[model samples]
Target chain A: MSDEPVRRQVTLANPNGLHLSPISALVKEAMNHEAELLISFDGNIANAKSTMELMLLGATCGAVLSVEATGVDAEVAAEAAVRLLSEP
Target chain B: MQVRSGIPVSPGVVVGPTLVLGSENFRIPRKFVSRDVVESEMVRFHNALDKVCQDIEDHEILVGEQLGSQYAAIFSAHLQMARDPRMVGQVEDAIRNQSNSPEYAVSRTLRKFAEQMQNLGNQYLAERALDIFDLEKRLLRELLGESREELSNLTEPVVILAHDLTPGETAMLNTDYVLGFATEVGGHTSHTAILAGALEIPAVVGLGRCLAGVSGGETVILDGDHGQVVIDPDEATMERFRTSQARNIRVSERLATLETLESETLDGQRVQIFGNIEFPQEVEQCVKRGADGVGLYRTEFLYLGGNKEPTESDHYEAYKQVLSTCGDRPVVIRTLDIGADKVPARIRDRFAESQNPMLGLRSIRLSLQSTPLFKVQLRAILRAAVHGNVRIMFPLVSSLLEFRQAKMILMDVMEDLEDENIEFARDIPIGMMVEVPSAVMLIEEFAREVDFFSIGTNDLIQYTLACDRSDPSVANLYRSGDPSILRMIQAVLKAGEQYGKPVTVCGQMSSDPRFVPLLLGLGLRQISATPHSIPRLKEVVRNISIPEAERIATHACSLDLARDVEHYLLGELGRLCPDLVV
Candidate 1:
């Protein structure tokens, strides 16, 4: 499989921001796809599949961030991250 | 006569004729189906799914308006999942293998997945099973041409009897006519039970198959305190229950008039009566009941009401609303009391999974640990304090050092705001709830530093009894009337006396009228309860003399055991007013 990187801008709809529950949701989605996923905001980057890393990002509500993934499932990972961010 | 028993989820003795709410699920035979028949069943299933989706969509507008868009997302997801092609493929495969109608096949397949998900043991994944089954059931009902059963509107009070109740269904109940509830399928921890407890309605759950035998309009006696449903009772049982119901009605009516009247003892001692509120809507109830002010405005509701952590603006708006409603009346805003069980959808991430959450990171402990979250809530409350007579309070302050540390953080936040040229109240009195046993043990030290004390008896009793209030098996052990609980109350009251600081009981026990005289007797001059209970508590307070109450309290304290003290108080209560028994 060809490895590629793709990124998308998403806004956190959850009020708790990038807290444990949403981070868990995002991590689960990232784990489902065969891709290396990462999210960045305010010059800080975190592995999308690592709850501890995502939480350290301190992404609060209404924060705009970019989720990027590389590998065969990068496109699907990007799409799923966008979906997670868009979820209420 | 048949009597069935289960766990009582709410306290209250309600007696009324039974109103059996029957749901007729359509039986679609599982047999080999021809291609043509499968096609028709598929169309029916889709039609049903569409209708249910439309129903959810309709509710979305209403619920969205109240709880905001986040809650509406649950339905939005459901709508999308209903039409997911993967689910469609699964349903088709099931129908082909079983030769059943599309709706039956879908329901059975979803049930299977739900069972499998249950065994997986992930809460997030397991919760999704309900959505799948709910959608399938909706589709099957529609395909089978069965309408959702609507609860009957009874002009007379009646006990609700159903096989099971959905959270939404229980939410829609008319509180006025529904005396109590009994269900056959749910346990004490079920959604129905939780909702019932929130509603403060008497409810009994997990009675097994006995619900099927109950007929509509049967003179059923639902003892919510014991979770016993008595059908076709003899005259004596009927009379006893009727009298209890009459007493309940009479007490409520008497309390209703107390809101507007000054809460002065018969000897003319003025006492302050405040209401404990969880939401802004309760302010109206407080006003109608003539509450002097809000003693404990639990600020956690702003966090708990939705999935996301409330913004500073959200916190400010809610605080402003409550403060504005109170006008000059003092409103003590307690900081977040979030624990493992009580964490709102918002800000739950800050907490780690604690094996013993009650003793874990929560209340002032959690607040002090996180400066950012603590400061945001503090700044918002301080700003709102400028709008009205708002006071700031902290929960679970186990030590004097913790109290000082919290105050230091508040001072830091205030200084930062001052540097920004933002306005806030710096002179607001800071108080702490004396819920933790350690706090109570050292009330004198705590009283010396804090401006006030609000005794949270619910947790006090729970911690003292070492019982989880939600645990049915040990629920009997958790009683505020226990001598140990009364002793703690007395200790706190005396500490307030020594320190000359205002003390208030602002827990579930405060709303309980039976305890009002006892609280007054214990020299507790300030009581805060729910808005609905404020008037009744006021009535009880107004009827007795402070000296008499003090005498009773002294007598109560003299008892060697908690049970004996409770017995003495109950006997005194009976002698005081036989008609007041509820």
Candidate 2:
């Protein structure tokens, strides 16, 4: 298991932007991972698994966000975060 | 009777008993707990969260059954928030360390999240703050052992009035019991407004502090047609509402007959009535309303809402949607025309902030500056042209040189597509929006180069008078019926005549029934307007002969004052279509 966190950059693709539906779905996906995940966007950082915090990021459609995860499953968590956020 | 005005997002008339939802913020009872009770308070907080989650799940099922799964997604969001681990941790921590009551901790934690969301500076994200507050309210109700006044439980017919509605609450509003709704605070773009429209529930929003004066069970008249809500109306207003309701039904019944008919004059001259739409979804409405085709599909929506600059495929998909819907009908796809300030921050960061964004690097200027971005849209439009009749129209092209530059990029994109052997429609007729004064003045030069001309009367009126369109003080001067606007359209029309190309008035001027006569009188054979205005324009179009329209135009053009020009045209329209029900 790696001590250092893995990171991936993802941009929001939903036309309605980071409204509740996407935030809720993203939070649910992030919670699925065993790794500790964090999402950073426009100087705002939030626990990726926290629906409230992720929503607080206020990422609109096309916002480039940095996703970080740490644990043995950090790489897998980062991949999942990227896939969820970047899908059009 | 108190007359309240708001931005109408849905269309209907309803008179019903008002069900005003007062503030959900109840008294917390107490703020703190004894240190010895902290462990018990944490347990109570978790229990309330569990109960709130159950309430949310119940709503998910009810909303899913009533309003479809798309709207039910709101509850799913709420459910996730209720079960949020960090949020739960925060509430539990407040109880364990701070010795706060479960109710106090829940209120404090959720309010902090809600306030943070509201101040996020993004409109969509800000609206989601209501969902947090909704969750807080639900949890509070559970913790307090209080009954909730859920709209899904309504039995009698009533109009739901509220301070503000969460998307989840708005979604579950049973149309069977909920005749219509209004709110003290909400914009036309708010989820309440959007859901109201989706539910076909007549709604008025952003009525300010008017709700505090009225009580529940008061007789309310919500006229979404006029964006008005009348409480305790006078006899005259009541009579008028009854007549207006009858008139609304009559007007639609009258307009419904013209759906399949061509917009032809009494003299048998065919005028093309096209739809000007922002979204691809609106294309169906335009088609359903018998628009000859899409005259102006504003492509800025693709760039404006999203964080990323739309890919070629993004543009291609949007164009394909519009073109596929239009089928063989000519669909003139207007390329990106929004200003930089309106785009996402990433794009906005690229442009130097200007005092006046309207006159700044926007439309063709922004496109020319970023040929890569411009080429992506052009390539997509060309590729989508293969789907159906597609014409690429450049917006706000102020100069022949600017128009040439845009054309060169389009030509370049075409060459690239050809080199790559990507299938694309080559014979796409390229046009420029004849909005800018310089473009109108150089119509003769532009006529020699471009395929068609669309007189963007909104910008033309604004630019011709140098009156900011958004400025209320100058709004009176920003008339589409201005003599200068008519003269410019005439010049463009004359040029179109010489060039043997179609010149359409695709601005707000074309959609207006009063100006329809003047525009037709000025020899515009095509009118592209929003779908809602199509049937009325078509009624006016079919009623008058080209000779009559020409006479009206000549009289209107002769008038010095815009008011006189508009008044004369309105009078003529009334005479032409005496039964102008639409």
Q: What is candidate 2's lDDT per residue for B155-245, written digit by digit as tens? A: 6888877878765567667889889988887655444565575466788877775654453555789987667999878889889889978
The per-model lDDT (C-alpha) reads 0.74, 0.80
Candidate 2 residue pairs that clash: A61-B307, A62-B307, A62-B308, B521-B549
Cα lDDT tens digits for candidate 1, B1-582: 778877776667776667666464233333246776766766766677778879888877878999998887666656555655446666777666555666456655555555554444545554655666577667766665644334643466777888777655676677888888888766553445655754667888877656433335557888876678887788988888888778777777766665567889899988888887766767766777788899888765565444567778898999898888778999988998766456654566667777887788877888888778888898898887889998888888888999999999999989988999999888999999888889989999898899999998877877787877555466557677788888889899999999998899987677666787789988888998766656656666667898888888888778777678667776776666554544
Error of 1 at B97 (Å): 35
- Can you tell me the DockQ of model 1? 0.02
Question: In model 1, where do residues sit more than 4 Å from their true spots?
Answer: A1-88, B1-247, B345-350
The DockQ-based CAPRI class assigned to model 2 is: medium
User: Which predicted model would earn the best lDDT?
Assistant: 2
TM-scores of the candidates are 0.62, 0.60
Give the CAPRI class of candidate 1: incorrect
